[model samples]
Target: MKQVEEILKRNHLSVTDSRQKIMQFFLNSKGALAHADIEKKTGENFDRVTVYRTLQSFVEKGIIHLIPTKDNSIKYALCKDDCEAGHHHDNHVHFICDECSKTICLDDVTVPQVKLPKGFTPQHAEMVVNGICGDCK
Candidate 1:
């Protein structure tokens, strides 16, 4: 509860039931989740618009990040320690299991720096390695 409050306060968002519930869901999640996944797990009582707006708020606040998938489905994941207001540097590799469609943060693997062509500036990088997760194997 205290953590939730602090997160909301830092993001300059007012605390609400939906926000708190979303925060708790993120905390309990083992990996990244799709919007539909969240709606399914939380139950039907949760409004779709409410969840969408809540997620948008979280993204803007840097509490989480939007990861784009090859299939065009956007996934949300918790931000790492390097994240800050309006900007985030995850610096961690992500593992996406093709079998289970699970997106897990591989904390042990830090993202390696890449050399870009001159006159190019890099902000953040999203590296996801797709394979069969241990549980699915």
Candidate 2:
């Protein structure tokens, strides 16, 4: 798609079919996607390693981000913020809908700041809320 091409150019990543299809999947997605799910979606077009490598490159380019799930499996979602390579400002809470089991990025809800004792430093913080989404309610 034209939009996908522009995003790839803006990110300074060369346009490729693998990247295009994978990125499109994220673009049209409703919520976070697991690696296996992505593979299943693109299995006929790409191999497992290609999908994995593409995901890693996308993360490095800040096109997508990782979401932590309760079962320990990671998921990917598009970066709504102005994320740059090696630097991302996706400091917001993620929501997991209990009814539909979808992972959504609550962009308007930011993660709460935590207080640390003296001599301690904080690098990053993330929050995941599990509930029924508005769609389900």
Candidate 3:
């Protein structure tokens, strides 16, 4: 709860039950979770619209990041180690398990620094590797 307050204060957002609950859920989760998966697992009475709106707010605040699956479903994950409230660190790869549709942050396998041609600027990058995870294998 104190951590949530600190996070909210740093992000310029007010601490609320819904927001705290949402953040705690992610912190407790083993990996990334889709919106639908969260709703199912939380067993809370929050409507889908509420969840979506909360997720949107969190993403906009840079407290979480949006990761899209190959099938186009959007998953939400906690920010990277260096991520702050208003700024994001999106230079990491995501690993998606083909068997269970689970997504894990491959922080250890960060994208290698790339050398782009001159006059090019890279704002962000993401790589998705699809395979069977250990739990599913």
- Best candidate (score: lDDT): 2
Kindly report which residue stretches of model 2 are placed more than 4 angstroms away from their true locations once superposed. 42-44, 82-90, 117-119
Best-fitting candidate, measured by TM-score? 2
lDDT of 3 by residue, 93-136 (tens): 88888898788888677777788999999977678899999998
Residues 52-77, candidate 2: write the lDDT tens digits. Answer: 99899888877788888879888998
lDDT string, candidate 1, 107-131, tens digits: 6787888999999999877777999
What lDDT score is found at residue 69 in candidate 2?
A: 80
Evaluated against the true structure, the overall lDDT of model 1 is 0.80
Return the TM-score for each candidate structure.
0.82, 0.88, 0.83
Count of clashing pairs, candidate 2: 0
For model 3, the stretches where C-alpha displacement exceeds 4 angstroms are 80-90, 113-122
Query: What are the root-mean-square deviations of the candidates from the true structure over C-alphas?
Result: 2.9, 2.6, 2.8
For each candidate, the alpha-carbon lDDT, in order, equals 0.80, 0.84, 0.79
